[model samples]
Target chain A: MTPLRIVTQLLEIAAALIAAPAFLGWVNQCRAWLQNRRAPSVLQPYYGLRKLFGKDVILAENASALFRFAPYAVFGTMVAAAAIIPSMGTGLPLSTAADAIALVGLLATARVFVSLAAMDVGTAFGTLGARREMMVGFLAEPALLMVLFVAAMISHTTSLPLIAEGLTTRALALYPSLAFTAVAFTLVLLAENARIPVDNPATHLELTMIHEAMLLEYSGRHLAMMEWAAALKLFNYACIGFALFIPWGTGTEAGGPAALMLAAPLLALKLAVAGAGLAVVETLSAKLRVFRAPEFLATAFLLAVLGLLVYLLLGA
Target chain B: MAPLSFDLQLLNGCAALLLLLSFSMLSQRRIVNLVNLLALQGALLCAATLLVAVRTGQGHLYLSAVLTLALKVVGLPLLLHRLIRRLNVYWDAEPVINASGTMLIGLLIVVFAFGLAQPISALASTATRSTLGIAIAVILLAFLTMITRRKAMSQVVAFLSMENGLFFGAMSATYGMPMVVELGVALDVLVAMLVLGVFFFQIREQFDSLDLHHLESLKETE
Candidate 1:
């Protein structure tokens, strides 16, 4: 691997690792502001993580080895996801493995591990949460793939970095297909990240909770790892969205690692804007009933497929 | 290439927005929101027509765009809102099919429209010919909305949306029809809306409800 490529890859992963929690905190702070509550510090997640990490582990009575292993597996997979997304540069050594299908597979792997761990505890809420999470996963995955397919179709390759690079270098033009896919991708992002109108990330009420219900059995560092992984997943998804839609700042390969360095502030700016938009969406809409989650995701899927059709029809 | 003397990308963006507005109207249950979506559709149609007019140097299309803004966007929606107020049909009852099923059918109709428009799009020479499939899809989806909806006001909105799709189809395929024909069609649509508005009152008076289901009882028994 070229030294610059390797450095850019590591830089991207490390930045995502550090910024993920901050991104979550930003969204939470924005939500609090929009709801007219006193806003928390944007560093609130880091404070919570520090507190959680310093505590001792406490596990369920019948916790299996799998329960102990899932948190690390999930965290590792999200980091791996972050590594491949080309947020800082389009010429990473890991770009070979950054195929859109492979990226989807990595995400699915993390979801599987988390769901399996949730069911391992055997609590009623745990199993219920696992079921709901799986339902969302299956429904959202196809839409996610369809979103990527439209991008891939345009770039004539399934590789994420290549798509971003292709779009960056091409002359400016509007792809109606991209417009349609963007709406679909936003819907998928909201659902996959347990955001509003699908599942409320803030809800802890037993009957209504989906993501939180799964983590009720974990405590201490394990819980911290799981929460960190959740944040990283959101960060990674946001980066993917950036890579697909607003890929301008990442720069073409001829610009080199200097361009990668230049991308950092732009990435931060995008995260800030996207996080605020997410908060606005969550504030404006109520969570759908659990039964309606399928319909919500179904609409996302249809919109993504509509993007593909638009691409085909317009040949754009 | 001097950028073709017009923004083709802007035209495509407008076409995409028109399709999205169509989908929003299809899924909307509130009569008021459906009327608003129809007006939004008209605005996008006007924008697309203006783009084509600029590209082709056809002065008639500009007149058509202004007509669209005045009639479809302003007049029809205002008329529909008054009908909704007078008829007092605010919320549509449960559609004949659920939202998810309706979306699935709409998706199929879109695919079929693309397939059907393929040969025609190839033969057409206009800058917006590629949007022909979307125009046809809009028409069919509007038709689908009419079939699945239960309220008279919603059906009227869907009918106007269908007219929008037809107008879009004509624009994409031929840069627009002859001005006389376009004006004649606009008058026809305005007259049709008025007649439909009167029928809304007659139906409400006869059946005491705006739900088309009320008229079903009057169907000749087998």
Candidate 2:
């Protein structure tokens, strides 16, 4: 690869890694503000990461290689995912390998690893969580694929950079298909990220937890990596959606030093708005009972299918 | 035009034959025999895809061919056969539609599929675009089979067979999908088979028959 492209990819990766913690903090601050309480500092998540990194890890006596390696795998997949998404612009060297479909595959791969590790310990809760995780993933993937296909049809390409470029540079007209898909994608994102109306990320209640239940046995640095990976994944998802839906602020093909500087603040602004929006969504929605998750996802599936039908029939 | 490459003709002929077999399996009601037809369909799909891969020099098609051979031809059929023997669902009691009715529906779907494929063929820019209609026919027929069959195992086989049709379509239209996609689909089919295998046991445990009409009761009826 050319050095310039490599440098750009490195920059994007660094930005993603640094902005991940800040993004988490920003969401918390927004939530606190909305609740009319004094918010923690925006650096709180960074501090948490630092403190976790410094602590030594304790492992279970029965921990297998899979359990020990899951953290790294999780972190690696998240980092790889972050690299593919156009956090700042569409000019990363990784763009060649960064297919929208492949992005979903990477997320699914990480999930499979994490679920297997969760089950390796043989705890009842862990097994329960793993089974539930698989069920959610099983239902979520087809919806996500259909969503991706909607965007793919619009751009005539599955590449993230190409999609972003097409959306931004092409006509300013609105697409009804993408509008439907965007809503469906937002719901899937909430469910996939374990947000409200699906699973409460804040709740440690064993009966209610989905993402958290699997992480119950983890502590210290391992937990930190998992947490950071989760944050990175949320960040990646947001950026991907932003690039796909709102690609205005990102730099163009002619990437000069000035373009890069402009993209930085633009991306930050987008994230801030997204963080607030996410907080509002989480605040407004109530967590559904676990049994109802299928109905919720089924609704998402129907919406996606409807979107596809609109695209096919209306020739959008 | 010069005679199509030997491998290309073989692939095309096999593709057409595979679609025909898929329609046959869709109309069949005997559970044991359906699984056998599905296995044969898988074998034909594997052979077709391999022929295309060899002619086009796309290495990924070989992997896809192997995947089809291992998963569809051998693994899934074996699982379904075992599921049938264990569940004792040698014959579906009665289809949701009789064989003749379902076959007539299948025939209509094939016509619609050809009509739908015309525009796709115009844009495909592939020698095998004509087979695209056959592919769509296979998929719709499988869907019809799923809707018409009473046995759960039959639906599962139809689902896998539908995937075979999609694979064939991709090969004929685009010379095969990306390697990563083929790999992902292969993994998905494997996992789906294993998961469905377990589900069969659970279903049999609950109902003592593989008939899926029982699952219709699972709907949240008002």
Candidate 3:
């Protein structure tokens, strides 16, 4: 890779890391506004992260070493995922590892580590959360793979960058398969990110919460890392969505560094519309019962499979 | 195959939406939602027919599209809504198989339909021929919905969806049947619907509920 390209990639990664929490803050603000509540500042997540990093971590009486290390592991995996997903350009050097299937694997690894650490301290809420989290991951992972598989079949490649580039430059863009997979991927995204209608990100009910349940035992920097990683995970998912469904603004098939520069504002615009759409969806739907989550994921899985079938039948 | 033009893509999207609506109906236990899903499916079928008509320059297909719009989208859903209100069978307690299991089977059926149509789709020269597999999938899913559902009204909904799938399959495979055949089928559907409306009251009068499980008791007694 050229030095200029490498520098551009690093800048993209850093921009993502810095912008991740702000994206979360934006979604929250939009959700608050839609719900007719006083909105929190768009910098709320940053302030929360800073305050979290400065506090002291409390240890459980029977805390294991794994509990101490899981935050870093999850945070590192999220960073790896963000690096691999093309934010502004699809041809970053790390794009080689940006196979959408492999990205799912990375997310699963982070999930497993966090769950293992959740159960390490022998807390009831921690165990409950970990169990629920694994269940969601188990169902969601296949639906995600199926979504990627449909996109891969369309572009005839498994590499995310190549898929993005190919789809961006392809002729006759009204793909029925892409349309079906987009719907499926949206469902998977909501479930994976602990968004509404699956698990409420903002909820902390003892019997219902999934992500927050796992973090009940974490404190200080570890808590900050976990929370920050979650935000980064959300950002990565949005980037992945852009790369697949709306890869036009990406600099992959366009001019060199200048295209990358232009892509930033476009990315922000897509994210703004996407985040507000997410908020409206969250505002509209109620959470399903824990038992009903499988059916929800099943709908996603079936939709993804149907997309594949459409591609196979229609060759679109 | 015809070129992947905007109209063809729009037709394919309509088929995909139809398939989705079929699965939605299969999983739905609320009668209101099931009826709504059926109406949506009818609307999609109307849209697909209109698209096929416009793209192929077939004048007859336009009449069929209007028929689908009037009968399936407007007439049947309105009739079903009134049937539901009068019969008070708004909640389907459960199905023979659960919602998710029905969906899993429905997915397999779709795959099977595509496989079944792969060879046939190759020989067909229609502009919308690619959607034949989806039409078949829609047909089988409607049948599955019929078999698994407990309520008789939903069974009737599933039956209408089956006819819808047949209509869509015919249109995709051959640009629709002769106009005479289309008119006859539409008349048959209206008659069957009216007859079933009468049958529902007879059965409900006898059993005090529309659940078809009550019919099993009428079998030969030892």
DockQ values per model: 0.60, 0.02, 0.70
lDDT tens readout by residue for model 3, B75-131: 989999999999988898789987778888888899899889989988999877888
Give the per-residue lDDT of model 1 (tens digit) for B1-222. 222223777877777778778888989999899999999999989988888888889999999999999999999899888878877889999999999889988999999999999999999988788889989999999999999998888998999999999999999999899999999999999999999888988988887888898887856463
Q: Give the Å shift of residue B133 in candidate 2.
A: 22
Deviation of model 1 at A286, angstroms? 2.0
Model 3: lDDT of residue B3: 45
**Residue A257 in candidate 3 has what lDDT?**
79
**Best-to-worst ranking by DockQ:** 3, 1, 2
Candidate 2 per-residue C-alpha lDDT over B7-61 given as tens digits, one digit per residue, 9 for 90 to 100: 6555555754565576568656788889899899989988888777777787878
**Winning candidate number (lDDT):** 1
Off by over 4 Å in 3: B1-3, B219-222
Q: What is the DockQ of candidate 1?
A: 0.60
TM-score of candidate 2 relative to the true fold: 0.60
A1-316 per-residue lDDT for model 1 (tens digits): 7788778888888999999999999999999999999999999999999999999999888999999999999999999999989898887888796598999999999999999999998999999999999999999999999999999998899999999998898877777788778888999999889898988888777597889989999889999999999999999999999999999999556888678778999999999999999999999999899999999899889889988988887766
Docking quality category of candidate 1 according to DockQ thresholds: medium
Q: TM-score for all predictions?
A: 0.96, 0.60, 0.96
Residue clash pairs of candidate 2 = none
lDDT of every model, 2 decimals: 0.90, 0.81, 0.89
Question: What CAPRI grade goes to candidate 2?
Answer: incorrect
DockQ of candidate 3 (2 decimals): 0.70
